[model samples]
Target: MKRQFAVIGLGRFGGSVCCALIEQGMEVLAIDQDEARVNKYRDLVTHAVVADATDEQALKHLGIRNFEHVIIAIGDNIQASILTTLILDELGVEHITVKAQNDYHEKVLTKIGAERIVHPERDMGVRLAHHLLSKNVLDYLELSDKHSIIEIIASTKMSGKTLMKLDVRAKFGCNVMAIKRGREIIVSPQATQLIKEEDILIVIGADEDIKRFEHEMFDE
Candidate 1:
């Protein structure tokens, strides 16, 4: 059976996480104090509950500790967010992922034993900066502080170049992990495989190498 999960606080970040989890076929319970917000996603998740995350009795009633993972995405209310995380920790929730409003909030979450903390707004800002620099950058994912995986639309200049001809690994120090052509995906493509116009390339490498590849090959 798929692992069950719960998301507390139906704000932007929590709502997005719940939607993505549901789309991935997970059993997600969306929880929020606001009835309107809970009703908004009533049909999107396996369950939507209107309850106060800070109320220990309410969480226990929902069997919050039984879920494999529970995400606390409370908005700007730092104290409530921390208290909810602390309560989850006390209840022995399997895994707790909390959204931090800022650096200070992250530190507190860390101190409270949060398994994972996400700074969604800050991360999105970083992704947006890269998009503004290039139109071909369809998406960007940071793998580490210095490495990333990025998606780009294969340009007309690269439409006919085979992997052997372009030699991104040898020249730009990046690896094309896969190519998406229309509805088909070619993963771990052979060197003889050629690029086609409108194809999407999923490339991974150090941030600097990716920048060089984009400027020299894709953008130029």
Candidate 2:
């Protein structure tokens, strides 16, 4: 079944989400106060409209509550985002995800019952910092503050070692969830699978343990 989405605020963040959802074959209603932004995405989404999201009547007229998920991506205007989220919650929208400008904004959204909150800038910064600090780490995603999924290049020392020999789970408290080499990907790689140099290992574990594994596996 195709899920319906309503994206309010046609800023960079919201616009990207709208486009991505459309690409995935989901129905999207793109809303923005700026006419130009709405026009830009008019053909891309199922519907595009220029309206202030903080206006409850405008939202109601658009049948926003019918959407499975609504993303509040109002940039800069924290007040507008909060008010819009509050109205969506009141209207019983099934799920609401909000983009927060800061900690205070996130707290306000949490109090108002936003289902999820994203800090895109903060997350990007963390990923970039990790990549710069560690040559082996290609990408990092925070599942929580404590746990993460990381992609790292297989080190020379691990080139011929298998999962059973490394004892990753028992020794480092990490798991190699997948292995990617060139165009091939192996999901739930076997215990006997060898780690070849240049192969990318997708590892998941607590943040501390992941860091420890990185240091031990790829110390330079």
Q: Please report the candidate that would top TM-score against the real structure.
A: 2
TM-score of 1: 0.88
TM-score of 2: 0.98
> Could you give candidate 1's per-residue lDDT for residues 3-102 as a string of tens digits?
7999999998999999999889999999999999999999999999999999999999999999999999999899999999999999999799999989
Q: State the lDDT of candidate 2 residue by residue for 11-46, as single tens digits.
A: 899999998999999999999999999999999999
RMSD of each: 2.1, 0.9
**Top lDDT hit:** 2
lDDT of the structure predicted as candidate 1: 0.93
Regions of candidate 2 where Cα sits further than 4 Å from its true position: none
Model 2, position 183, has a per-residue lDDT of 98
Model 2: weakest 10-residue lDDT segment is: 211-220
Instruction: After the best TM-score superposition of candidate 2, give how far the Cα of residue 106 lies from its true spot, in angstroms.
Output: 1.1
Task: State each model's CA lDDT, in order.
Answer: 0.93, 0.94
